[model samples]
Target: MRVNKLTIAALAVVAGLSLTACQNDDTAGTGRSDSSSSSKGSHSGGSAQDTAKDSAGNDSGEGQDTAAGTGSAKNGATGKCRTDELEVTAQDGTIGGDEDNTVAVTFTNGGGRDCSIAGFAGVDLKTNAGTVSAERSGEPAPATVLKDGESVSFSVSYPANDTGGSGVRVTGLVVTPPNETKSVTLDWPGAASLPVTDGSGTPVRVGPIGSAGQGS
Candidate 1:
């Protein structure tokens, strides 16, 4: 009876040890599963954060470009003048036959901004034999910045030749702005005839554009 009792007690101890070992193994497997889940969640969060940073960086670069474009347009100090923003006219300023026969050509800035009308302006006499060329002056001067509604006048003068009915008769004149290709045709109000040679070889004389009226 004592040996039987001892054997049964030893079997109970072994069974208890096997149960505890199984429980420890299960706990270790559960811990591994939980760690894997946490690692996947961390990776997903890092990917989302990287995407957001890239988007914000692109938006910031685009905003800077837009601001630069706006600033350049607002400050037009070094901008060149356009032909569509000007108002041109011509009139006869001739006094008598002995004096210099002059024609006043005026240019006015019609826009709300300031611009420059410097350099030599090209002139053309619109005649039936196409257009006649004009000579540009060689004098150098500073450029005048014309404000809104400000005007500048330039004169085209020539020596009077009161011969017979032999001089050319030009009905109008075409004036070209400096560094511009477009031309404006204005009426001529001088006299019966202009004492300029035809388009054979001589070119009409032109002066520099001067300030007119009272706007600085």
Candidate 2:
């Protein structure tokens, strides 16, 4: 069969249209795509175009945050920090002169989003006997927004066994992130086993959760 010049021109136009469609699919991420954009034929057809658009949205910053598996709450979307995405730890205890010591509860963001957390983190001191939930300071605090790898901390001050008498051996600690149901567990960081007036109760004072670089 002999091909005419007109037929060649038509095929070239079709090829150009296909390439342009693919590019549009690849670039449409967030904020709603323009209705004016056009797409007719893709090299891999409609399936390819759909996949490209989906990927573009998923790869965007806000998209990654909303879809992140770490349960992180995105800033504008949820405004609550996910518990599972935080790495919680307790630093060594520093004893204040008044028979009380401060333990630092550090929270690091290990996810992809900027999240906000506030108030007193649920703290519990655990022993073989039972669990003692922490009391809130009842003071309001500004929500701390954290980016990836950013951290926030709070202080828990408890009475030290100054009398050096028989004291209960502290075994475990439980920490809950703000507005999250999940909690983080850590080992007791007491200079020695904490002493209590009685094994049944321990008076623990906790500070409000604050942003990184702020004194807890």
Candidate 3:
């Protein structure tokens, strides 16, 4: 009877040890599965972050390109009118009365781009006596922008002597556009004789540049 009891106790102890070994194996397997899942999650998060960074980088690059394009456009804007790019002409007309003779000087933009002009042109009548520079009128001079093939005009005015023999004989005109140092020479559009003064004895006056047909 004593031997049987001892045998029973030994069997119970062996069973308990086997059960503990099985529990340990299950815990280890669960820990390995949790570690693998965590590693995969970390890899997925890293990939997402990388993708977001790349998208942000692309957006930043595009913004810089747009700004560069705007700067380039500003650098390539239209400039001021040049004397060599204009075609100038003169025509004869009368104001107030037939005795008040006027010369309309027209400037046409012959360039390929738009340009600006303002104020009075420097006008000097080439006379047999010498060069007579014109006086500016009190009219308001505004800035004028001229596109390709567009034209602007100003006026040079003097009274007709009609007395037949007491005036300057103007043979030509030397015209310089506003703010320009160069000049162009054109033939006088009126009779060779021009009175240096008006009825009030005002010297020859020049009007401000204006749109076509606005001269005088």
Candidate 4:
């Protein structure tokens, strides 16, 4: 009986040793797997951060481009200047014969910078047929100044005269600023006949005008 008991005890010791070995192998394998998973997670986080930084850079670049484009339109008609902001318009019922054709020449400074109206002059009247040429017969309008984004105008008068028998009246308008000269023709299809006949039996006033829309 004692010998049998000893053999059974040895067999139980061997079984316990085998179980310990298996447990140690399982723990080592689990540790290796955990370490690999941690490394992969670290690499993924670094890649995400890099992507975020790249996206932010692209956005900043786009913003800069947009601002540059807007600035250009404000200075040049296409990208930087407000070229169309300045213009001229004539008043209604302001044109007639014998009476001062009260006209207004308007100027607008579309540039970001301010500008001034130095002075203005009226050009002589010319005919399409080239038969007649009128002299600077009347007084010119006075000098005027303008501010940035601001506008102003003055009045002009035309006398009543027979437009050289051709019956066509054409007048030239010229406005001279410190930096530029603007000209435009004021066309009257037919010169209004003067109420009184002149000494030469020709109509006294009325003619076509050429425009000098030249500006600096």
Candidate 5:
């Protein structure tokens, strides 16, 4: 009976050891699974955060660009005077054979804002025929003031010897308004010897500025 009891006790001990081994293995597997799940979740969260940051940065950059463009356009339109719509027309007027023949030029100010036409010397006039001419009357010594929707007419004097006839070929004209620079091209008859009708409807009545025989 004692041998039988000892054998049963050893068997119980072995069974308990086996159950403990199985429990330890199960615990290790559960720990590994939990660790893997935690790692995956952490990596996914990090990637999501990075994507959100990138999206936010891109949106901010676009907003800044749009704002800058708007501001630049507004300032350019309001704070500056350009050659936008400013024009000069030359008409053949009778100068009566003076050494310097006077030509009628109509100056039109076509801007949204008022600007000073100061700096007469600042304004430059060039003829396509290589004649160097200067502004004659209404020249504001240094500049003149021209308001929007206003027009001024003045005479630009040129030497009769400098130009063959009233057919003046305008090349370039620049007016330096206060805080603004304006320039335009004169492609029409700058000097004329005959009354020619302008198809452009500027009514430039071209005629002999000095000698009417010169052809343009």
Candidate 6:
């Protein structure tokens, strides 16, 4: 009976130790699972943050590119003067015989914004006989900026015919501003006329566009 009691006690002790060991192993496994989950969550959060940062960087770059393209388009649209924005006029500069006959043609910016002009203007002398296109003078054409309500002028020169019989009857003048395609017509300065040619048979000439009051 004593041996049996001792054996029973030993078996109880062994079973308790085994149960405690199983509990410890389960708790350790649960702890390891929780740690792994936390590590995975941390890695996922880092990846999300990195993705957000990359997306923001890409968005910023695209924004800059879009702004640059818009600026370029705006400049291309508004940098040059349009034909409808200008008011053209012509005045006789020097119309006489035996001299260089010149007409002062002015262009006023009637638009609400500033614009630029460069190069020579296209000029045509309209006569009862036919239309005569003017040649460009040998002068440098500097780019000029005209503010709203500002003006620029150019000169149209032709050879004078001392013999009045050889002159053409000028009725009107067709003027086109620099870098423009549309044209404006103005009645020839009162009672003015142009000769078909001087003794040298020189063609009508148009000077470059210049500042106001400084006819080119």
Q: CA lDDT, every prediction?
A: 0.75, 0.73, 0.84, 0.48, 0.52, 0.80
lDDT of 6: 0.80
lDDT tens digits by residue: candidate 2, 1-216:
256888988999999999999888777752244433434334348888789898887689676676784565322364567887888989855744444677888988887767777788888988755676767655667777788899888887776676776665678889988777888889988655566655464477677887222323
Residues 18-37 of candidate 1: C-alpha lDDT, one tens digit per residue = 99999999999999999999
- Badly placed stretches (over 4 Å) of model 3 are 1-77, 95-99, 196-202, 211-216
Off by more than 4 A, model 4: 64-105, 114-216
By lDDT, the best candidate is 3
TM-score of each: 0.61, 0.59, 0.59, 0.40, 0.44, 0.60
Q: Could you tell me the TM-score of candidate 4?
A: 0.40
Candidate 4 residue lDDT tens string, 27-80: 999999999999999999999999999999999999999999988866753221
For all candidates, what are the clash counts? 0, 0, 0, 32, 20, 0
Model 5 poorest ten-residue lDDT run: 207-216
Backbone clashes in model 3, listed as residue pairs: none
- Which lDDT tens digits does candidate 5 get at residues 99-215? 444455455678766655432322345555443434333322433456787755554444343434455455654433334455544533344332222334322222211212221
Runs in model 6 lying further than 4 Å from the true structure: 1-72, 75-78, 95-98, 198-202, 211-216
Winning candidate number (TM-score): 1
Instruction: State the weakest 10-residue window (summed lDDT) of model 4.
Output: 207-216
Q: Which segments of model 1 are wrong by more than 4 Å? A: 1-67, 73-78, 97-99, 196-200, 211-216
